[model samples]
Target chain A: MNTLVLTRNDLSVIVQAFGRDALMDEVLAQLRIALREYDPSRTQSLRRQGFVYEKPRLGVLEWMPVMRVSRQVVIKVVAYNPGNPDDVGLPTIVSTISVYDPATGHLVALLDGILLTALRTGAASAVATQILARPGSSIVGIIGCGAQAVTQLHALSRVMQIQEVLFFDTDPSAVASFPRRTAFLGLSMKSAPPNVVARASDVLCTATSVEVGKGPVFEDSDLKPWIHVNAVGSDLPGKIEVPLSLLKRSLVCPDFLEQALIEGESQQLDASEVGPSLSDLVKRQQDFEAYRSRPTVFDSTGYALEDMVATEIVLKHARALGLGRELAIENILADPRNPYGPLDVQASRPAQDRALP
Target chain B: MNTLVLTRNDLSVIVQAFGRDALMDEVLAQLRIALREYDPSRTQSLRRQGFVYEKPRLGVLEWMPVMRVSRQVVIKVVAYNPGNPDDVGLPTIVSTISVYDPATGHLVALLDGILLTALRTGAASAVATQILARPGSSIVGIIGCGAQAVTQLHALSRVMQIQEVLFFDTDPSAVASFPRRTAFLGLSMKSAPPNVVARASDVLCTATSVEVGKGPVFEDSDLKPWIHVNAVGSDLPGKIEVPLSLLKRSLVCPDFLEQALIEGESQQLDASEVGPSLSDLVKRQQDFEAYRSRPTVFDSTGYALEDMVATEIVLKHARALGLGRELAIENILADPRNPYGPLDVQASRPAQDRALP
Candidate 1:
């Protein structure tokens, strides 16, 4: 059987054709449905397994695998190289998602996970913001105007009436380019310092690439009492982006608690201080109504379930538009017992002519 | 950047051109070198992580990732479906190997892992047999003549001067087709019962797909005193091919100790009863010479290092022969900070034309 291969261009075509707002809306809706109907016994999502190395310029390669029982398995292999942007002019994260047939273990599709990852992460934050942020929350504050900041703005715009964006970044070029990169959104944008952005908005997103052990992008003093924070950049140990003092008092909900405790902003707080998961909030919105009136934090470490939902939406659109290449990557043998059946043995020379090296 | 995609057809072309014996010989040699020079600090090979489900079918999908410090990362995603052979007309295991550039987290190559897995597994057994099997061994016996049996015989033939082969399988068709499938080897072959095959051999291989709870393909009664058996089929907990009684009296060397304790044949024995790992045996051959004169078992659980070596060999040959397709799978953006730069925005409709559903 042939596996459908979707390149980055194909994914871009999907975004251009379907429109980012519609796509993120579908992702948000599907994520809510997936969370609402999720049964832990049926859907198995594990913490990522990978290697972190310092020699090859401080990077990590991880594999996130999630299985929907009797359905399909989605595995996303992602690499995070902190120095890629300056050293090699590449994004900090590069990834690919592979989907497999559960019954026969056949690879069904392979898609570019770079854009998918950013899109899904944005949708995850939107899911949390819609549930926790106050109604009619319009002003959005963004720290770290990098690649992730655009999607964070776009996704929140889809869920909230994001009319004005106040942003800050350590890099002057990223700060200058933010308005141009997000010009299509047509929202009034302003470049400001961290503390200025922190105190002026009702919903804030921290997506900075702050150096390890030097975080808490802004202090907890000059913030709105009812502002909701989406802490997005603390994906590695010792790399938190939010202040601990802010998290201790707020309703800190993590996307995946087991993973967030190790990598997300929740790492700074004790397990007992952390509130319910995003899924828990989605399942019982009425139970968490009290947290909307207070400061809240959504610590997102990125879960495999988000990738699964994102991949499903991408594949659905790709298949409908007929926008991928189908390649016979695996050897589907006529006789399952003979692996050698696929060899082009006619081209082989005699055994006597070939000797061991 | 482009990723070199090697399909099963491409891999078959490599095997057909390089010759199976020569390829197996090179794999065996490289495996020896890799094991001898292995340092846990530099090469981080983790235990596999995935899911096993028994829903529509009984199957497992696992990702095995290994990273060589300052070098590349190799991940092999494999699926094991016990009902594949009879129910779906596919191999019991299907897999794909992806090689990533550690410096930038760029995927350099994607290769079909069906034949690669079988070849590397056989090479792993040969590495152990060459060190622990008797010198100048001629008679070879094989139990459970399935897909893995062919490679086991081929790899052993590369290390020993085999003149005759005695094989047995509960499946009559597998027993009847064994000789024809391995006709190119030109060795005399006979089909016999499991006990008869076990009693008349200097080296033996057990590659069966026995049920999880129903195992011990052959009893320990009529075996030769100095026979060395490569147990290649016991890869899951409580799924052993060799008898526990036999393992207790013999020196059992596992490919990976920690993994074997959970999934390999070494699970039948206590921690102290098991011998050193295969790498340990390669690193200190002199220390294990005494076991060559007695009954010994090589518990093969299949490690990621083996897959890494196998992938390197295949990529080297593929590069030299120009046998695989190079596709631009990932977006190498000019501006590292703009993920949306690749979108065909000119083709997109106006915002008012596309609204959220």
Candidate 2:
């Protein structure tokens, strides 16, 4: 059997062929179904396992695995190097995702994970915002205008009637380029200070790469009463973007509770203080309608289930468009009992005289 | 940067260029150095994490990750399906190994892991046999003549002056094809019952695919007093190959103590009954020389360190021969700050008019 290999270019073709808005809509709909129907007995997603190193540069390499019982297994191998952009002209994160057949253990497909990760994260936040944000929420605030900010705005635009965007960043160039990068969304964009962005918005997103222990990106005093915040930047132990004081007053729901406590904004609060999980909110949206009148937070640390959903979307599009190469990467041996069968075939040895090096 | 991709065919070319015996010697030498110089502070090899499923078929998919502080990280994703050979004519285990750069998280190379896994397991046992087996041991016994037995006999031939081979398996075809598959080694081969193979041997290797909770592949009374057994097949809970009575009387050294205690022959013995680790034996060979006078067990459940060493050898050979293909699998964006830069380039959009789907 051959494994389908998709490159970054192929993924771009997929996104362009199927309009971005349409793809986001499909992802949002699928994610809602996956979250609403999640059964602990059928789906298994373990916390990521990897190493955090401090030499050569500060970085982490992690493996996130999620298995759908009797169906398939999807795993993403990601590397986060904080110094990649300035030092080596590379993105801060790089990753690859692989899908395997549960019964045969055959690799079905391998896809580039850079764009998939960003898109799925954006969709996850959109799901949260749809359930927790006020129905009339229109003005969106974005802090730390980096790569993630583009998808955050795009995915929210798909779910909400976003009219204007207020954004801020410490880097002048990033603030200047934000409008051009997301001009396709056709929304009014303004570059403002952090406090101004926080206070004049119905919803806010914090996606900064702030140093550990350096933040709660904006103070709680500078926020509106019904603002829904998608806390996207606090993925490391001491790195937080939303203030603990703000989380205490708000109804904080985490994407994955156990993982969020270790690395997300929920790390600031005790387990008892946190609200229901995103899955719970997804299952029972009507039960939490009262939270739309107060402050709310969706703490996302990125889950493997989102990756699995995104992979399904990408592979479906790739298959329809025939946009990847099929390679015989594994040895599907002619004789299953002998691993040396391939070597013997290569040397053209007779069965009785077969020899391995 | 491009990632070098090696398929099964490319790996076959590499093995044919450098003789298998020469390669095993190199692997054995590097493994000894890596084990002797291993320091917990510099190297981190976590226990593997994955899922074990029993629907459609009984199988497991696991990820083994090991890091050499500040240098590199090697990860192996393996799938073990016991029913593959009979149901689909595929090998029982299929896997792929990936190497990542620590500084940039760039995937340096991806290689086929089927043959590499077998070679490394056999070489690990050879390292143990050289340390614990009696020097004049010329007779070798192999229980369960499957794919692993070929490499087991070949690797032992490189380390010992073996004159005869006695092997047995429940499957008659496996027993019939053993000598032809190992024709290169040119050793005397005989097929016998389990007790006979266990009795007339100086060193025994048990690599059976025994069912869970139905083990002790051979009886304790049918063995030599000073024989060293390389227990290779007991990698899951409730699955053991060597009898508990034999393990109680032997000096049992595990390849990795923590992992062995969970899935290897060491699972049958208490923590207090286990001897020093393989790394300990490699570091202080003279201190454990007395083990050669009694029965010893090398509980080999496999480790990531062996895979790391084997990958280094294969890559060195591939580079020297200028083999394998290089593909640009990742998106190294022209503008590091913008994830949509590639899409803009693909669509020929000017920088100011850049838009993502």
Candidate 3:
């Protein structure tokens, strides 16, 4: 069987074909469908997550998260090697996605997961902003001007009137470069400190690239009431981007409740502190503005549904354009009864050659 | 940057180049190293198993089992579609093996897991037989004669001296065709019922193709004293091939304790009743003849390391011969800082074409 191999360049082309607005619209629609078909009781059977291995005893660990959404089966294998950038000039987070045919257990596509991850995550934050942020939200503050920062602006712009964006990064170079990188969006930008961004924005998005046990970007005193926070970067155990004091006083909505309780910023607080998840929010449309008296947190630990949707988007576009290269990775046996028939043919080749000689 | 895609033809050739004895030897050596590197305390972190998705509401669910052995990470995706054979003429169990480089999170190879699974599983049973069975065992009895049946005999022959063989299957045609298919092995064969085969053999292997909750092939009364039973078929939550009474009477050894407890025949009995795992057996030197008075059951639910080792064997032979094709699936970015540079090129190409027009 043939498997479509979509490289990073291919995905980039696909994402560009459909602009950020259309891509976010497709992702949001897929997320809705994902939530509608999801049975909360089957969550246990739906996904599995674990640390695969640790290199050098105490160094970074590779994590594998596998999940199935309806007919789509996805396994995202990512390595969180802290030393990759310094050692090999590769990104700290490297991932490969395997998409399978659930009916036949055949791998239909192998995707570059690093870019897909960023887009899906940005879209998830956009979804949360659409559902949880107060009406007419305009000004947006973004902390951590890294790879994810551009996507966050691109996605959030599709959902909200992002007329002005404030960028804050500890690295002065990152702060200096954010404006030029995002200049194509035609949105005015200002470089501000963390506290200034926190106090002056209608919505706050934290996508900091911090090590485990890093300091919180801002204290509880800095956050403004009614300003929604998309805590996108704290996705592993011991990784905190938001303070516990702020989370305790806010209506925290997780992307997926179980995952956020473990890997999201809500991991720091008690279970009771976290409110309904994004799935729950999509399932039951609540008057989100009623609970906007305090800061809201969409604890954005990336979900498998978002990845599957983004992958489906890429696969659909690739197949439509006939763009991806076909790899003969899987074998289709002619006869099931003689599974070893191929091996016998190889084993007998030498005898045949010798006989001919 | 390049992943070697090994098709069934490639794997068949590789396995033939290595032969059964060398293949089994390599698998056994890898098993030993796997057990040595395995920390019983870290069992929870080393392996993750879960159902991927279910079709037709409650029908067969695709299962994914992932594990890490040192720097190598492997994920085996198996789809168990009950309606496959009649509906689509496909095997009930369709599997694919994905091997990744943990350090770089790069996929090194994608091997056809269907054949690899059979070979690895058969090798696992053979490894257990070599460790647990009596030294002078000769006669072999196989309960089922399907796809796995051939490999069981092939793997066992490499580890033991089989002067005579007995085959038993409910399907008369399967029983009739076993000898001709395995005629290369040049072993005397006997067609017998399950009870007769159970009572007469020194090594009794139950590789039956039975549905979940089906009747057991044989009971405790049918077992010969000191006969080692390689229970290789039952590997799901509700599936059973061996009688619990027989399991209760035998010293059951699981391939992996936690997995066997969930998917092996041990699922029928309490966790306390299951004896030492095969890893434990491989880790320690045990006196086999001392415990030969009672029946021994090697509960093989299949482990990820076996697949990795078997893949490594295939990969080593394939790489040495340069037999597999490379797929350009992932792109290594020239500048890590400019993650979106590829998209910019795609976006600018259209504008450049427009300017020329």
A1-357 in candidate 2: lDDT tens per residue?
Answer: 887888777877887777666677778788889999999789999888678888888788888899999998999888877778778988777878889887877788887777777788889999999999988999999998877788899889877888889999988978988888787677899999888999988999998888888898888886888999999876688889998898999999998898899989999999999999899999999999999989999998889999999999989999999888787776667777676664553333222322323
lDDT of 1 by residue, B264-329 (tens): 899888899999899999999999888888899999988999999999999999999998888776
Better of 2 and 3 by DockQ: 2
C-alpha positional error of residue A94 in candidate 3 after TM-score superposition, expressed in Å:
2.0
- For TM-score, the strongest prediction is 1
First chain TM-score for all predictions? 0.96, 0.94, 0.87
> Model-by-model lDDT, in order?
0.86, 0.84, 0.71
Q: Which digits, one per residue and each the tens of the lDDT, describe model 3 over residues A1-357?
A: 777777666766766776544565677677677765667544332333645345542233343444453565676766665455446766555677877766776778887777677678888888888888878889999998866787788778767777789879887867877776676567889988898888877888998767677758876775667889998886567888888888887889987777777778988888887898787777775756576556788999777767777777778888987787776565456545445664554342222221100
- Candidate 3 chain B weakest lDDT stretch, 10 residues: B348-357
lDDT, candidate 3, B103-185, per-residue tens: 76667777777777777878788888887787888989999876677778877877788889998988786788788767656
RMSD of each: 1.8, 3.5, 4.4
Better of 1 and 2 by TM-score: 1
- The DockQ of each candidate is 0.57, 0.41, 0.33
Interface RMSD of 3: 6.5
Q: How does candidate 1 fare on TM-score?
A: 0.97
* lDDT tens digits by residue: candidate 1, A129-196: 99999887889999998878888998897788777899999989889888887876778999998999
Residue B217 in candidate 2 has what lDDT? 87
Residue B112 error, candidate 2, Å:
1.0
| Model 1 complex DockQ against the native | 0.57
Clashing residue pairs, backbone N/CA/C < 3 A, model 1: none
Q: Native contact fraction of candidate 2?
A: 0.43
Q: After superposition, how far is residue B315 of candidate 2 from its true place, in Å?
A: 1.7
As for DockQ, the candidate ahead, 1 or 3, is 1
